[model samples]
Target: MAIKYKVLPRKNPRDIAAPEKFYAAAIADGDVDLDRLAELISYQCTVTATDCYAVLHSLEHNIIGELEQGRIVKLGRLGNFQVGISSEGKDTATEVTTTNIVKSRILFRPGKRLRSMLNGLTFKKAG
Candidate 1:
């Protein structure tokens, strides 16, 4: 017995680049406000504009706080964010964890789907 296979059409990033161009033009022309732009981007990820902004704001604050503490912060599967230290001396930096010079780092554990996506085994190309 013989089996037949068909190639499925995929939308490459390049294929969708025009939409990005249009979005940029719209924003540059002031056709859409910041809230609308946020909404458009959020829509791509199936999330609400408020939720998207909240996530972005949270990440910004968390990163800033981590850097202020003089410690490396790692968000599992996402990647590590480190703040550079001056060569002057470590003593000048405030420790993230009190009572000890060594600061305790913060780690964000990735959710199940994110973890699986990072592992790169769950996805298969269509044929």
Candidate 2:
């Protein structure tokens, strides 16, 4: 049996124009209403405004909660995020032991499928 695969046109940062431009053009074209356009974009992008905000909130809470307890949180296929201490003033090279002096950062690790897809495809410039 032949393997079936869906081929999506690769889009580069340069290939994409400003969202405002596209939105304006779409509105001018009258192909859809504002609400319909919003819904279409949301569905195609796998996220809506509400969903994005919720996800951001969840991530912030999870990371902060873990760090407060001195634990590294590992998001599957998205890497390990951690909070670590740093000293201020002249002793910038050393880590501070105090809980009050720490920095938080989010780390990401791409999944195998995502990595493979990235490696396998080459983006072509749209004329």
Candidate 3:
């Protein structure tokens, strides 16, 4: 199925007074949460919906645990999950410490299969 997108007008960031340009932004048709995902997966495999849900739930839990331990979690064909940090610079290396660490965020890097899927996507203007 072709992805849907809508034209959106955005001003140039470097020059706020510049005329706006229109761009196509993709839109999601809907969301399929964990429960729905389990059912869909069960259809493709022998696992029951409940069992699949349990495994998915556990996977989510374990991924968080791994990330908290300062390790990257790599799920084949899915992606890699890791923690990223933004920090304030110190005048000297000796002055640098955890206090300089401003913020942290979870980052996802899509694996090869996901990247290929993204590259193959076809789009259509939204109705």
Candidate achieving the largest lDDT = 3
lDDT of 3 at 57: 98
Preferred candidate (lDDT higher): 2 or 3 = 3
The alpha-carbon RMSD values of the candidates against the true structure, listed in the order shown, are 15.9, 13.6, 1.8
lDDT of 1 at 125: 27
CA displacement after TM-score superposition, residue 61 of candidate 3 (Å): 0.6
Which sections of candidate 3 miss by over 4 Å?
89-91
In candidate 1, which residue ranges exceed 4 Å CA deviation?
Answer: 1-41, 88-127
Model 2 per-residue lDDT tens digits across residues 35-123: 56556667778789566556666777877888778787877775566655454544554544565455544444565665676566434
> Residue 117 of candidate 3: its Cα lDDT?
94
Model number with the top TM-score: 3
Residue-level lDDT for 113 in candidate 2:
65
* All candidates: TM-score: 0.35, 0.35, 0.87
Location of the lowest summed lDDT over 10 successive residues in candidate 1: 21-30
Residue 45 lDDT in candidate 3: 99
lDDT of 1 by residue, 1-127 (tens): 1222334344458676443322111112126655676788897998889987777678779888877887677766666666543233345566433444344344555556676774553332223
